[model samples]
Target: MPSPRLPEASFPLHLPHVWSGSEMGAQEGICAPSTHACLDAQLPGNGWPVGGVVEVLQAQPEDHVWRLLLPALGQAVQAHAGPVVLINAPREPFGPGLKAHGLPAERLLSIHADKPSARVWATEQALRCADVAAVLAWLPQVKSAELRRLHLASHQQERMFFVFRPLHVQADASPARLRVMVEGHEALKVHILKRRGPPLASPVLLAAQTGRLAELLQARKGRAAPPQAALPVKPITPTPSLAHLATAAIKGPAPGQQKIKEESNVERIASALDRIALPG
Candidate 1:
C-alpha cells in the first residue's frame, strides 16, 4: 500500500511580499485599478487610493507618464465621476492622443500657471471641484508644506490628483499617500518609492505603445502623436445637474489655509475652466 499521504495544509502567513495586500482586506479602503494588477497587489488598498494623491517623479517630459495613469483616469471618466484637469502643463493637450486613449474631448480641461505659487493655488482650486475625475500638475518647485496642503484638499473632495516633480527631488520628503519614480522610453519602469502599508522592494514595469518602443519591437503603431496645445487661463463653470442645480464643490482649503494665508502674500488664483455644457 502506498504510504499515507500527508493532509493538505494552508499556510496563512507564508506569502510573497507582493501578496501581502490580500491580508489587508477590503476594509483598508484601497482602490486597486485592474489595469495594473501587479501594482494593485502591492498597494495597501490593493490599488491606487480612490481619493488620494499620487506623486510621480520623471526625468523627461513625455506622454508616456500620462499613459501610465490613463488607465485609471479613463476608468474614472467612463464611470461619469468627473472631468480630468491638468494645471501648468508643460506641453499642449493633443486632442488625438487623448481621444485615442478613451478620454472624452468634452471632459478635458487644462490650466496654464507658470508661477510655482500660481500653480499651487490653481491645483488647490481644481481639487476643490468635487466632480473632477483627476488633476495633473507639473509643479517642480512645490515645497513640502504645499504638498501637505494639496494632500488635505484631495481627501476633502475624494478626487484623484497627480503631481509631477523632477526625478532629482526623489530624496525630498513628501506627504503624498503614494510616491513613485518613473523612468523609461517605451517599456516604462516604475519604482514604488513610498506606499501606505510597506515600501516596495522592486520596480514595476508599465508597458505602453510609445513610438520609440514600438520601433524597437518592430511593430505597427497608431498614428503619430498629436501636437501639444496651449492651456486656457479662464475657468469654465461646471455643469449644473439640470432642473435642480447641483451643490457647489468649490470649497477652499480652510482652517490650515487660513494659517497659510496669513504667512503668504499670494493673490487669489482664478482660471478659465472648459467643459461642453450639456442640455438640461
Candidate 2:
C-alpha cells in the first residue's frame, strides 16, 4: 500500500543567520571555563573563547601562568591532539615542574628566536598552524596593524593564540577577543582589561602550590648544577713599576744618562735590523 507523500520543503544551501542579544545562537560567545572556577565565573561566556586570540599583558613572562592554564591547556592538547608551542621563551622550561603538573615533555615544544622580528615571524607562523594546540609568544613591542594580522591568522586555525606583551599595553587598543594582564603574586592574579562583554573590575586569583613548588626545588637542589664553561684565562696584566713611571715622568733629553740610554736603544734596534736577512 502506497502512503500519501508530504510536500517537499527546500532550504537555502547557505543561510547566514544574523544574530542579536535577544535570540540565543551558537555563533555567539560560547566559552569553556577557565582552569579556575572563580575566574571562569568572571569571564565572558563563562570563560575565555576557545578559538580566539587572547593577548596576555604582563610585566614579566614566566611559567607561573602555566599553573593557571594547566587544566585548560591539558584539555586543549587532548582535544586537538597537538603540542603546545612556545615562541621566544624567556628561559628554558623546567621539565620536572611541567611533569608534576601533568603535561608531558612530548606535549611541549619551545622555539627560541632571539630577534624580535624573528620571534614575530615565528609567532605568526605558529599561530597559523592548525596542528598546534596553543601558542604563547612574548612580544615586547608590536604595531597595532601587525597584531591585527596576527589576530586574523590566529582565528584562521581556530586554535588558541596568546601574545604576551608588556603590561603597559593594557591601555593600548588591540584586536584580540580577550586581553588580560597576568601578574605574578603569591597567587596567580589575572585581570581582564579588555573583552567583548561587560567590563570586569576585579582581578581573579588562582592558588599556587607552595608545597609542590618547594618539593620540586628540593629535588632539583640535589642534582649538580651545570658546570659552567671555564672562562678564558685573561693574560696577566703586570702592574707597572714605580721606577718606570718615575723614569717616564722625568724630562726626556735633559738627563745626559737618559739620553745616552735612548741612543743605546736606537743602536740596538739598528743592529737588530742589520742582522735580519733581506729577500733577494
Candidate 3:
C-alpha cells in the first residue's frame, strides 16, 4: 500500500532555519539588517549573518567598506549598545565622517596592528569581548587557516564579523558563510560571490553615499559653480638703470624735470599698492 502524502501547507517552510536550495536560507540566529534593501533581499535571512564571518573582497582595502557596512554597523551600535572594533584599518577613522553616517566615534574601537598575525589575533580577541557588537578586520596577508580560525571564533559568539581581503583571494577557499565582491565608485556594484542559496546573476547597485552626505553631494553636483573673478593685470614699467640715472643727473634739469620725478614716484607707489592687493 502507498503511504499517505504530507499536505503542502504542512511543509517545513514556516521554519525560520529551513529553506530549499532554490530559495535563500534563513538565519536561525539573530541578524543585523544591512540597510541596503536590495543587498538585504539577496542576503540569507534577509540580513547579515551574526554567527559567521562575512568575507568582503575588493580591489582596494577602503573602496566600499564604509558604504556597504555603515548602515549595519550603525544599527549594531544602537541595538547591541556595544563598540564596533576595527583591526588594522588602512587609515584612521574620520570621526566627523562616522558621525555623518549616524555612527558616533565613541562607539568605535580601533586597533592598529602592522603585522598580519597581529591583525588576525586582534580580530579574534575582539570577537571574544562581550562589549564588542561588530568586528571589521583587514587581513590582506592572512592565510586560509587563519581565516578559518577567525570564523570558528566568530561562530562561537553572536556578533557581526567582516574580514576584508584582496579580490584575487576569492578564488581560494574560505570558511566564511557569506562572500561578496564590491566594485564601482559613484554606486557600489556588489556581487554575491558565495551564499547559502543560488548564485546571483547580476550585481546589486548600492548608493555610495546616503542621508545628508548624499544630499550635499547631489546638491553640489546639481548646482552650477559661480564664475571666478579675473584678476586685474597691471602693466610693468621698466626700472631706470644706474647708468641712465647718472646720464639724467649729468644732463642737469631739462623741460619738466621735477614733474617727471614726481610722476615716477607716483608709479612706484601704485606698483607697491598692486603687490599688496594681489594674493600670494
Candidate 4:
C-alpha cells in the first residue's frame, strides 16, 4: 500500500455563513446617508440614488433653475468629500452666484464647453473622476441613451450627476431618477415631472434669492442687525440775484414780467448746476 486513505468525515470543515444584506446595508449606509434627508426624500438608496441621472428643466435663464437644485447638490457635497464639477454648455454658470448660494468657491470646478458633445464628454469624465463628488452638466439637449451612459458611469464611480436641460426636453422620457421643471417665482418652485417614488406631482417652494442650504446656514451664522436710518441732508437755496433785489425794492417790473424773469433765472441756475461737480 502506497498510502492510507483518510476518513472523509474526519476531514470535514466548519465555515461561517456570511449575510449579504447586513454587509450591503452597512456599506451603502456608510456611502449614502438617509435618503429622507435629501430633497423630496423620494430618491432611491435614501439619497440622490447614485449612478442615476437628474434633469433640471428651466423655462428661461432667469428662472433660477440652479437655485432649485442647490439643496440637493449642497447636501451631496456636504455628505461626500469630493469636488463638484459644473460643465457649462450653452452659457456660462455664474460662479459668484453659486458662491452666494453656499457652494464654496474652492469646492467647485467649472468647465465651459463650446459644443453639446464636448459638454457631455467633459461631464462624463468629471463624473468618473474619483475626486469629484458630483457633476452638473448644463446641456441644451440630452438623449435617453446619453443619460443611460451617464447613469452607468455614475454608478461605476459612485457619484451624483445632474443635468440642466432646456424646458423643451423635459417632456422626453429619460433614464434620470428624477426630472424637475424649475420655474421662476418670488420664490423658486420645483415641479416634479417624474420620480421613482411617491410625492409625485408635488411642488416644492424654495427662496429665489437664497438657496435652501444657504438660508439654513445663514440662520445659524446669526441674525443681521437692523439697518440704520440714513441721515437727512439739508437743502441749500441759491442766493437771489441783484436784479430780483432791485425789482423787490423798486417794484419796477409787472407781476408777469417778474415771473418770466424768475423762470429765466431758474433755467440759468439749472445749467450752472449741471456743469458743477458737487461733492458727495
Candidate 5:
C-alpha cells in the first residue's frame, strides 16, 4: 500500500492575557479619579461617578447650563467609543453648539419625543442599550419613583446617565447619586445638591474654557502671589455721523437718485460719499 500522505502540522494559537475572576473582581466597581482635580473633589472618584445619575438643572433658558455637561460627555465619547443619545422633548438641542463643544457630531444620536413621559421612556430604553455610552435627556419633570427606575437601569447596564430638569422639584427627593445645579457663565459653577461618599456642601467651579476643575488650593496660591501691573488702555473709536448712517441705510439709492450700474457701483459710492463729506 502507498504510504499515507504526511499530514500538515498545525501551530497552536497563543492568546493574549485575559483577566481572571479574581483580577476582574478586584477592579470591579472601583471609581477612579478624573483628570481634573476639581471634578474629582465633588464626584465620588476623580471623574463622574460611574453607574450613577447626574442631574443638570437650569434656572432659565439663556443660562447655558449645557456647558457644564459637555466636558463629561466629551470625555465619555472619547473614552468609550460608544454613541451618545440626546433625548429632546422640550426644545431641540443645538447641534452646532455641541460640535463646537468638542463632541463628535457623527457619534451623537438625537431623539425628539412629543411628550415628557415618552422622552423619559426613550431615555431609559437607550440607557439599557449596550451600544450607547451615555444618555442625556432634557426632561421637564418626573416623579422620584420614575427616576429610581432609571437609576436601576443605569446600574444594570453600567452606563452613564444624565437628566436635565428645568426646575427644582422640592417634593421629589431625587434618588440619583449626584444632583448638580449647573449655572453657566465664562466659568460654570456646579453645586453639589447631593452626594453619597462626601459632604454635599462643597461647591465646585468648572472652567468652561478648560475642562479642568477649579482647585481651592490653587486659587489660594494664586491669591497669595503679587498682583501684576495693569496694561495701558487704548481710546475707543468714534461712531459714524447720523447723516452718513442715513445715506448708508438707503437700500438701493435715495428717492430721486439714479441707481448705479453694478460694474461702477464701488466708484459711484465713493464719489457720492466724497460729495457729501460727513464728520468722522
Candidate 6:
C-alpha cells in the first residue's frame, strides 16, 4: 500500500531549503525584478538573485548587455541609493542613453582595467562595497576559480553581480547561481544554461528595446515618410532639318514669286535642250 502525500503548503514549513527539481526555487531573499515579464517568469526568484553571481554568455561582449541589464540596474540604483559600478566595460556609458533607460547618468561608476586579473579583483572589491548596488564585469578570459571568488564575495555583500564572458566558456565550470546565453537577432534570445529548476528547452525571446527607446522606435514606425519632391519637366522643341528648311524657303515666298521662279527654271531647261541639238 502507498502512503498519503503531504499538502503542498506543508513543504515550506517543514523543508524550507528543499524544493522539487521540476519547479523553480523559492526566493533566496529580496531580489531585483528583471522588468521583462517573460524573462522574470523563468527566473527562480522571478527576478535576479540578489546575492549570487549571474553569468551572461554572449557572442559579442558589449552588444546586448545594456539592453538586457538596463531595467534591473535602474531599479538597483533606486533601491540601494548607490552608484552602479561597471568593471572593465567594453565602452563608456552614454549619459543620455542611460538616462533614457531610467538609470540616472550620475549614478553610474565606470572602471577600466586591461588585465583580466585586475578586472576580477575590481569586481570582487566592488561586490564587497556597501555603496555599490550592482557590479558588471567583462572578463572574457577569467578562470572558474576567480569566478568562484567573486561568487563568494557576492554572497557576503548580497547585491546584484553579473559577469559577462564569451560564449565559448559555456562548457567550462562556473559558480554562477544562474547562467544564461544571450543570442542577438531581431530579438534577444536568452537560453537558460543553468538554473535551479528543470532545464528550459527553448530560449526566451525578448524585444531588443524597451522604455523610452521602445517608445521612440514605435513612434518612428508609426510616423509617415515625407513626400518626394517632383522634378520640373522642360518642354522639348524639335529642330527643322536642312530639307525641311529648304522646302519651306521655296514655298514660303509669295505665289507670284514662286510662279516666276518656276518659269525661269523651265526656260533654262528648254535653252539647254535646244543648245544640245535635235536628235532627228
Report the error of model 4 at residue 42, Å.
Answer: 5.7
lDDT-better candidate, 2 vs 5:
2
lDDT of 4 by residue, 111-226 (tens): 55444555566566667665466878777765678778987898777777777877888557787666777776557666767654444456766553546545644563485545
Give the higher-lDDT candidate: 2 or 4.
Answer: 2
Comparison by lDDT, 5 against 6, better one: 6
Q: TM-score for each prediction?
A: 0.68, 0.66, 0.69, 0.55, 0.57, 0.69
Weakest lDDT window of 10 consecutive positions for candidate 2:
271-280
TM-score head-to-head 3 vs 5, winner: 3
Give the Å error, residue 182, model 3: 0.2
Give the candidate number with the greatest TM-score: 6
Model 2 whole-model lDDT (C-alpha atoms)? 0.61
lDDT for 28 in candidate 5 is 31
Q: Write one digit per residue (lDDT tens) for candidate 3, span 128-235.
A: 766566889888999989899898888998778999889888799988889999888778899999988888999998875766666655665586666424234443
By summed lDDT, the worst window of 10 consecutive residues in model 3 runs over 271-280
The C-alpha stretches of model 5 lying farther than 4 A from their native spots are 1-35, 61-63, 79-81, 89-102, 208-280
Show where candidate 6 strays beyond 4 Å.
Answer: 1-17, 214-280
In candidate 6, what are the lDDT values of residues 100-207, reduced to their tens digit?
877765555555544566567656656877666788888898988888989999988887999888889999989898999998754789999998788899999998
Tens-digit lDDT track for model 1 on 1-280?
9998765674354444334542442323437373677666766666677666788898966666766776777777876545677776786554455556666555665655545776787678778775667788899999899999998998777777889999888889888878888888667788988774556677987666666434533432344645435343243455543111111112223434422222122221122234432223
Off by over 4 Å in 2: 1-32, 217-280
The residue-level lDDT of candidate 3 at 74 comes to 80
Instruction: Flag regions of model 3 displaced more than 4 Å.
Output: 1-20, 215-280
Cα lDDT computed for each candidate against the true fold: 0.64, 0.61, 0.69, 0.54, 0.56, 0.69
Per-residue error (Å), model 4, residue 96:
5.9
CA RMSD of each candidate after superposition: 9.4, 22.0, 24.5, 23.8, 20.2, 35.3
What ranking of all candidate models by lDDT puts the best one first?
3, 6, 1, 2, 5, 4
Kindly report the root-mean-square deviation of model 5 from the true structure over all alpha carbons: 20.2
Instruction: Give the C-alpha miss distance for residue 150 in model 1, angstroms.
Output: 0.7
> What lDDT does candidate 4 reach at residue 262?
29
